[model samples]
Target chain A: MSEMLWGIVFLLIALLVGFFITSPLLIIISPLVEWSALMPYTNRSKMTWLIFFLSVLYLLIFIGLVSLFQSNFNGMFSKELALIFLSIIVVEFIAVRTTQKSLYQLYEQNKWPQE
Target chain B: MNKDLVKIILVTAGAVLFNLVFWNEKLAINTVLFDAFLLCALFFLYPNARKSAAVNWLLLGHLVSLSMVVIHNTDLSKIAFVITLLLVAGFAEYIHRSAWFASGSMLMNVVMIVASFAESFKINKSKPANRKGIGRFIRFAIFPLILVIIFFLIYRGANNAFSDIANRIGAQLEIFFSHFFDFFSWQRLVFLLLGLLITGSILLKSKLDYFSTRETRMNDGLQRSRKPMRQKRNGAFFSFVEMIMGKMASGMMALKNENTTGIISLVLLNVLLLIVNGIDVDFLWLHFQYKPGLPVYIMVHEGTELLIVSIVLAMAILLFFFKGNLNFYKRNKWLKYGAYAWILQNAMLVSSVFLRDYYYILKHGLAYKRIGVLFFLLMVLIGLVTVFLKIWSRKTNYFLFRVNAWAGIVVLVLATTIHWDEFIAGYNLKRRNTVELDVPFLLSLSDKALPLLDTNIVALQKRENDTRVINVNDGQPACDTCFIEQLKQREKQFEQRQKEYTWLSWNYADAYTKQYFRKRGLITSIH
Candidate 1:
C-alpha cells in the first residue's frame, strides 16, 4: 500500500519484462527506485535483494539464450553484435543498479549522528 | 484513450519503423519516409502547432530538405535535413512560447530531449484514482511472472538435463523466440533506442522552458537607451584612448567624432572598392576570354577567394560603425549614405564574383567548388540584404543572424535537389569540343554519373587521347589504354554495388543507373 511497496513491485515487473520481453524495459526500475528512495518507509535490505535478484536473473537468461543461439548465429559480425548487446546490458546494470546502491549508501553515511 | 498510452504506442511504432527501414543501409528515400512519419506524429500529437505560421514554414522546409535526400542525397542535404529536424521539433514544442530563433530552438530541443529522461524520475504529486488497480495487477500478475522467469532461467542454466527437457517442451516457442531476438542485434537495438529518443524528444515536452522564457523577453527592434554608458574600470588602454580623444571621448561629442570617422572610412573604402569593381568589370565581366593554359588557377580561385573575404570584411565594418548610439546621432546622415554606397558597391563585387565563377564554369565545366562558390555567393547576397534591413529598421544583431541562418539553410537544401555528378558529366561531355574536358575529373565524380559516362565513353576516350599526346610531347610517360580500363573497372564496381541495394535504400539517380545497366544486359533484370 505504501510507496515503498509499489516501487518494489515495479522493480520486480521491470526485471521480469526486461529479461523476457525486452532489455530496455529494465530502465523502468531506475525511476521506481529513485521515487522509492524519497519515501519514509523505504527498506534498503529488501531493495538490495531485489536488485541482486534482477542482475542474477538477467545473467542466467543471457547465458541460456547465448548457449542456445550462439551456434545458430551466422557470422563474425553477429557474434560481435551479441557481444555489444551484452556489453550494453552490463553497463546498464551497473549504471542503474550500482548507482542506486551507492546513492543509498551515501544517504546512510551522511545521516546526522542523533538520527 | 490516455496520453501516456498513446505516447508509448507512438514510440513503439517509431522504433519498429526504424528497425525495419534503417537496419544497415545508406540514407535515401527511407530517411524521407521516416521524416514524413515523424511529421505526421507531430501533427497528430500537437495539432495546435500548425497555427503558428513559423512552425508551418519550418515543417515545409524540413520536408523539402528531407526530400532532397531522396533526390540526390548530398552531404549538404543530409546536414540540412538534420538541422531542419531540430528546428521543426523545437518550434513544435515551443511554438506559442517564444519568437523562436533557429539556433536557439535547436539547442533547446536537444537539451529538453536529454533532460526528459532524467525528469521522469521526479515524483508525480497528483495521484490518479486507478492506482489501486495498477497496484493489484503488479502484486498478483508481476510478482508471479518474475518468480517464474527467475526459476525458469536458474533451472535451465544450472542443469543441462533440465535444459534439454525444457528445450523439448518449448521447441516451437524457442523457434519463435529466436526469430524475435534476432531483431535485437546491437545495431538494431541502437536504432530502436534512437527511435525512442527522437520520438520522446519531439513528443514529450520537458518542463525546462529556458529558451522559451529567455526569448520571450527579447525583441527584434533595438530601442535607443538614453541611459549613460557604464564607465569601464579604467584599464591602461581605455585611459589612453580617452586621453587621445581629449574632450570627445565621453559624450555627444564622441558620437559626432565617431560618425565623422565612420563616414570618412566608408568613403575611402567605397572608393577603393570602386577601383576593384571597375577592374573586375573590365577583366572578368566584359572582356573575359578563356585562354588555354591561362593561369585560371590564379584568376578564378585566388580572385574569388579574395573578393569574398573583402565582401565579408565590408559587412563587418558596416556592423561595427552602426553598432550603438551612432544611429541616434543627429549628424549620422552622411555616415548612413556612405554605408549605402558601400553596400551597393559590395553587391557589385558579388556580381563580379559570380561572373568570374560563371566564366570558369563555362571554360572548365561543373565541379563541387564551382557550385559551392555559387551557393556561398547567394548566402553573401542574402546576408548583405539582411544587414541593410538591420540598419534601416534599427534591428538587433540577432535579427541579422536569424534571417541569414534561415537563408543558409534554404540554400543548402535547394542545392541538393539536383545530382551534381550527373550534371557535371553531362555538361563536360556536351562541351568536349570547346571546353577542356578533364577526363580525370569526370572519373572522380560519384557513381551517379555512371550512366552518363557509359553513354559517352567515346568522347571520354578522345579527350584522354588528346591529353595523353600532350603529356607525351611534354616528355611525360602516358598510358594509352589505362583510362578506358579504369572506366570499365568503375562501371563494374558500380553495377555490383547497385545490384545489392534493396528498396529501402533507393535513390532516383542510383535507380536510374541500375535500370540503364539492366537494359544493356550488363546487369540482370532479377533485382
Candidate 2:
C-alpha cells in the first residue's frame, strides 16, 4: 500500500511537470486540437471524455519515456544529443507561435466563432 | 474558446507548473517529449487557407516525417529532416496564400503571426465581487494553513503517537510546500506574473474589432459631419497635425522631383562599381593568388564581408533608384541598365567569393565558419536573384521581402540539419594528400571524428612516439622534430574527449566512439 502510494506521488509529480511545459504550447494550439478531436465525434460529452482519456495516455507515455531516459546512461549527458533535443524544441516553438498567431488574428478579425 | 479548450488549457498549464515545481532540470528528455507532443498538437491547431481547422493526409505525413527524424535521430535522417521541413514551410505558404512560388508578403504574414502572441492577453480592472472572491480564497487558504501549523505544534507537545502522525504528514507537506513556495522567489514570481499576463491576454483575445468598429466609427463621423463641423476644440493640436501632414506631402513632392540629388550620386556610384568589378574579375579571379602563403582565412572572412556589404548597398541603391519618378523616370534607360549591370556584377562577385571559399575548403579542410560563409553567400545569391526578379516583373517590395524571407528560412533549416563536425572530419580525413590535411583540427572534433580517424591511428601513434626522440646534436628543435610535435599536439586532443555514459545525456555518436575506442584499448569501458 505504501509502495502504491509513493508510485502515485511520483506519477502525479511527473504529470505536473509535463503539463506545465506543454500547456502554453497546447493553449496556443488548443482551437485546432479541439477542432480535430471534436470533428469526428458528435456528442460534446463523449468528446470531452475522449480528450481527457487521451491526455491521460499522453501523460503515461511521457512518464515511460522519461523513465527510459533515466535508465539508459545512468545520468551523464552528450552535448550532441542535447543539441538535437534543443533544436526540436526551438523549431516546435516557432511553428506553434506562428500558427496560433494566425489563428487568433483570423478569429478576431472575421469573428470566426468562439465555439 | 469552448469549455473543452478551457479544460485543455487548464490541464496543460497544470503540467507546466508541475514541471517547473517538481521536475525542472537542465538536461531532461521528459522536457523534450512534452515539447514534441505539444508541437504535434500544433499541426491540428494550424488554421487552413479557408480559415478552417482541417487535418489533411499531407499534413499528417509531414508531421510524421518530422517526428521520425526527431525521434530516430541518426546522421542521414537529419538530411531528410531538413529537406522535409523546408518543403513543409513552402507548402504551408502555398496553402495559406493559395499561390505557388509565394512572394515577399508572406514574410510579413510570418511577422504578424509571431507578433500576434502579444495580443493573446488582456487586463481589466477587478470588480468588487472579484476582489471579494480573491479575499475569500486567501481566507480559506490561510485559515487552513494556520490550523495545520497550530495542530501540528499541539500534536508534538501532546504525545508520542500524535507527534509521529504529525511528523509523517509534515514530511510530505514540506515537499509540497517548499516546491509551492519556491514559486514566490523573485525570479519565479516575475515569470509567474509574465505568465499571468500572457494567459490573461489569451483569455481576452479581442475579437478583432478592427473592421466592424472602423465601419461604425465612419458612419458615426458622417452622421456627426451632417450636423455641421463642430468648432475646433484645440486649434494648436489641429495645426500640429496639419503641419506633420504637410511635411509628408512635401517629402513625396521632393521624391518626385526630376533633379533628385540621388540620381547624380547614383551615376557616380555606378561608374565606381563598374571600375571595381573590372578589377575584381581582372585580378581577383583571373590572375588571383592574392595571398598564397597565408591561410585561406582572410579570403573567406574578409572577402565574404566585403561582398555581402556590396550586395546590401546595391539593394538599398536599387530600391532608392526605383522609387517615385524613377519607376518610369522618362528615358533613364542608361541608368536602369547601369543599375542592372551593377547587380549582375554583384552576382558574379558572390560566385567568385564562393570559388575562393571552395578553394580554401579544399586546401584547409572544412570549419564551422567556412560552412557558415557558404550559407551567407547562398543568401546573397538569393537576394541578387530577388533584385533581378523585382526589376523584371516590376513586383512590389513585398514580393522581394517575402521571397528573401522564404529563402532565408529554407537555408537556415537546411543548414541546421547537417552534422557538420562529422562531415568536416570525414571530408578532411578523406583528402588523399595527408600533407594538405588539417590533422590538428580534425583531432579536435567530437567522437564523430573517430570513425575516420581510426584508420590513421597507427601513423598518429608513430608520430606521437617520434616527438620524444628529438635530436639535440644540432641544438635546434626546429627540424623533423617539429612535425612530430604537431602530431603530438593532435594526439593530446584525445584527452579532452572523455566518454560519458548517462541516459540523461547519451548521444549515439559518443557511445559509438566509446565502444570503438574501448575495442582498440585506447579508453576504458565505462559501461
Q: Please report how far candidate 1 places residue A115 from its true position, in Å.
A: 28
lDDT of 2 at B478: 41
Q: CA lDDT of B1 in candidate 1?
A: 72
Restricting to chain A, the TM-score for each candidate equals 0.33, 0.31
Task: List residue ranges in candidate 1 displaced over 4 A.
Answer: A1-115, B96-100, B118-184, B231-247, B289-294, B473-478, B522-527
Among all windows of 10 consecutive residues in model 1 chain B, the one with the lowest summed lDDT is B114-123
Write the residue-wise lDDT of candidate 2 on A56-95 in tens digits.
4454544466568786553323333333444554544334
Candidate 2, residue B206: the lDDT equals: 24
Per-candidate DockQ values are 0.05, 0.03
Which lDDT tens digits does candidate 2 get at residues B1-527? 65446434643463455345323222223324533543343333433522322224224443444443444334444554434433343334343321123222233223222122332222234664664475466546766976775555555766778778878998997677546535545345445544443322222222232322322322101111211113332457434534654543234453334334445656777778678767767866788774767867776777787787888888987875663345554555666676677777788788778877887877777887888788888888889888877765555565676568656645644454555777787777667354355556776665556656666645554454454365435544443333334434443464343322135333455556556655765422111
| Tens-place lDDT digits, model 1, residues B37-56 | 88888778778888888787
Model 1's interface RMSD: 15.8
Looking at model 1, give its docking quality level: incorrect
Interface RMSD of each: 15.8, 17.6
